[model samples]
Target: MTGQPLDAGTIAELPKVLLHDHLDGGVRPSTLLELSDAQGLVLPADDAEGLASWFVTSAAAGSLEAYLATFDRTLAVMQSADALRRIAREAVEDLAADGVVYAEQRYAPELHVSGGLEPQQVVDAVTEGVEEGVAAAAGAGRRIRVAQVLTAMRTGGNAADVARLALENRLRGVLGFDLAGAEAGHPPSRHAAAFRTLRYASFPVTVHAGEAAGAGSVAEALHIAGAIRIGHGVHVIDDVVLGEPTEDDPWGVEKARFGDIAHWVRDQQVPLEVCPTSNVHTGATPSIAQHPVTPLLRLGFAVTVNTDNRLMSGTSLTQELAALVEHAGWTRDDLRDVTLTAAWNGFIHHDERAELVEDVIIPGFTERSNGRHRA
Candidate 1:
C-alpha cells in the first residue's frame, strides 16, 4: 500500500533512524554565539538568530567546497574539550527530541585538536557528552541511542590515525569510521590505508562520494576503499539512463538502464545516506522536488533520508522527510520503507539492528498508522 501522506507533527513523532548527521554541523546557534564570544572569535553575526540566518545563506553557495567553508566558524569554536562535549551532548539531545531512536553522529577528530587537545581526548570529551545527552534525553522521556563515527578529512593525511582511534574505541562509543570533505579531486582511494585498516578489523566504513564528483568516485569508494555505505551518493543518478515515460510508469524507473556501478549498488543494496536539503544547499541537486532521491528510491535502491547539517540546511530529520512528502510525493509507506532500510543498514550488530527495527521502528510506525486510521 502507498499509505496516506503524514503531516509534519505526525512525522515528527515517528521513530527515526539517522545514519549520517554531522556533529559540528548541528551545533545550536545560541551555543555557537556564546562559545564564540567566550573564545574571542569574531563571528559575522552577533545574535543567535542572525548567526543562524547567516549559516543558511552562506551555505547555499551552490558548491560543496563553498558549502564546507561555512564550517570554519563552527570548527573554530569546537577546539576545546568543553565545546566538543557540549556540541556532542546537544546534538544527541536534539535528535532525541526530534524522535530519533537511533543515530550515528560523525565528526573528524583531527579537526577538533587545533587547541592542543589530543585526538583521544577529543573522542573522550565527545563520548562524555554523548552519555550525558543520552541520560538527559531519557530523563526527559525521550529515549534515544547515539553512536560516534570517527571521520578523517580526505585531504588530511591522518586517515590511518582516525581509523585506529575508531577501532580502539569501538566498544566505548565509536561504532564506525568515515571519510568526508570536498569530493571533487580527493577520491576515496586517497585514504586506502585507513579503509584497509578498518576493513581488516571488520569495522564499518562509510565514504563521502558522488556528491561533488560523479559515479566514478562512487565506484572507487566501493571497490578501492571498501565503504559499506555511501554518503551523498546523489551523483550515482548520472550512471542511470532513463527511458521514455509511458502510462504504466510515470518516472520510467522500470525501463531505466543502470550502469555497472548502479546495478551493483542496487543489486547489493548498499545504503545511500541522502540529505535532501543539504544536497540542494550544496548544489548537488537543483531542488527538493527535482532531487534524484525519489527516482533512486522508486528504482529500488537502499535509500535512507538524513539531515546532513541541521544548522546549515536549517533542517531536522522531521523537516527532511516532510520536504520529501510535500515536494517529492513521499507517502507513509515510503517513510516506513526508508526507515526500515536505515535501521537494517545501521553500523550496529545484526541483533542490535534487529532489536531497533522490531522493537522501536516498526512499532512506532504501526502505532502512528493505527492512530491515524482511528482518528
Candidate 2:
C-alpha cells in the first residue's frame, strides 16, 4: 500500500516519536550565533545560514571522527547554565513545532562542565530548560512530552559517574542512560561498569553501535552492556547473507538468511533507532536508498526512524520521513509503523507509552491518512 510522497503540510501534521536525538547536536543556528558572541568565540561562519551549511558540509565528510569535530564549536558555546538551558528549551520548542509528540534527547553532562559548573548543575539547567520549553509549547497550543537521556562519552572514563547521575535524577525527568562517542576503538564494553549500574538499577540503556563499527560492537552492546536499544545498528546488515531463490520457491521465502547476531537482534525485538540522513552523513551507508532500515523492517526487525542531529543533518523528523517516503517508497502505513515502534521502545513509562500510542500517534496518523484518501 505504498502512497505518494508526503507533502510538507501532511508531514508537519503527523505525530512523531524521537528516540535518538542529541540536545547539543540540534541547537538552533541563530542561538549558536548569539551564544558564540556572548562567549567571545569566533565562528567559522558569521551568519546562521552559513553556519548551518558549514555544519552540514563538514558532517558530510564521510567519517565519524570528522563529523564529531563539528561539535567543538557547539560544545564551546554550551559551557554555561544559561546557554544549556536556552538551547535545551529551544530544542523542545522546535521539536514541538515540527509535530514531535514525544522525544528522548541525549547529551553528555561532562562535556558542559568546563565553565566551572558541576555535572549535576548542568543537568539541572537543561532539565529546567526542557520544563520551561514544554510549558511554553503548551501555552502555544502544542502538546509534547520530552525527557533527558544522560549520555556517557565512550572515549571518556566517566561512564560510571554519568550512569550514577542519570539514576539519581531519573525521577526528575532523566528517562535513561546512553553511550555515545567515536565508536571504532571505544566499544560499549569499555563502559561495562555504567551499563552494569543501570542494569542493577533497572534503568533503560541505549548505546551507539554499528554506526562506526560492525556487528561485534552491536553484539557487545547487547550481550555485555545490556542495552535495551541500539543506536544505528545498521552494520548488523554485515552479518546477514541473503540466499538465492529456486524454482520450487517463487516467493523467495527461504532466500534470506541471518547470522547469529542478526538473528538474536531480530528474535529479541531489540529496537534499532535508524537515523537515515545522519547515517549518510557519517558514511554508515552510501545514500538513503542504500540504508539497511527498509530491509530490516521487512525482515521484522524492530526499526524506528529518527533525526540524530537536526543541525548536523539539516533535517527534522518530517524531513527524515519525507526522505524515506521519496527514496524508499514507504507508504504512510510504514511511517505509522515506525512511529509506533519508537513509541513502544521509548524510555518512558509503559502507561505513558500506551497513552501516546492511543491518544496521539495512532489517531494523528489516522487523521492524516484519511485526509489524504478523501483528497
User: Which candidate tops TM-score?
Assistant: 1
TM-score of 1: 0.97
- The 10 consecutive residues of candidate 1 with the worst lDDT sum are 366-375
Model 1 agreement with the true structure over 1-375: per-residue lDDT tens digits? 339887899899999999999999999999999999998889999898999999999999998888999999899999999999999999999999999999999999999988999999999999999999999998998878888999999888999999999999999989998899987778777788888888899999899988888999989999988999999898999999988878776678888999999999999999999999999999989999999999999999999999999999999999999999998889999999999999999988999999999988888898888784211
Instruction: Report how far residue 216 has shifted in candidate 1, in Å.
Output: 0.8
Question: What are the RMSD figures for all models against the true structure?
Answer: 1.7, 2.6
Candidate 2 residues 1-375, lDDT tens each? Answer: 235567766878889899999998999999999989987899999999999999999999999988899999899999999999999999999999999999999999999999999999999999999999999999888889999999999999999999999999999999899899888778777777888888999999999999989998999989988999999999988888755646654323356788999999999999999999999998889988767887788778899999999999999999999888888777887888899999998999999999999998887877777774211
Model 1 RMSD in angstroms: 1.7
In model 1, the Cα lDDT at residue 265 comes to: 91
How many clashes in each candidate? 0, 0
Off by over 4 Å in 1: 372-375
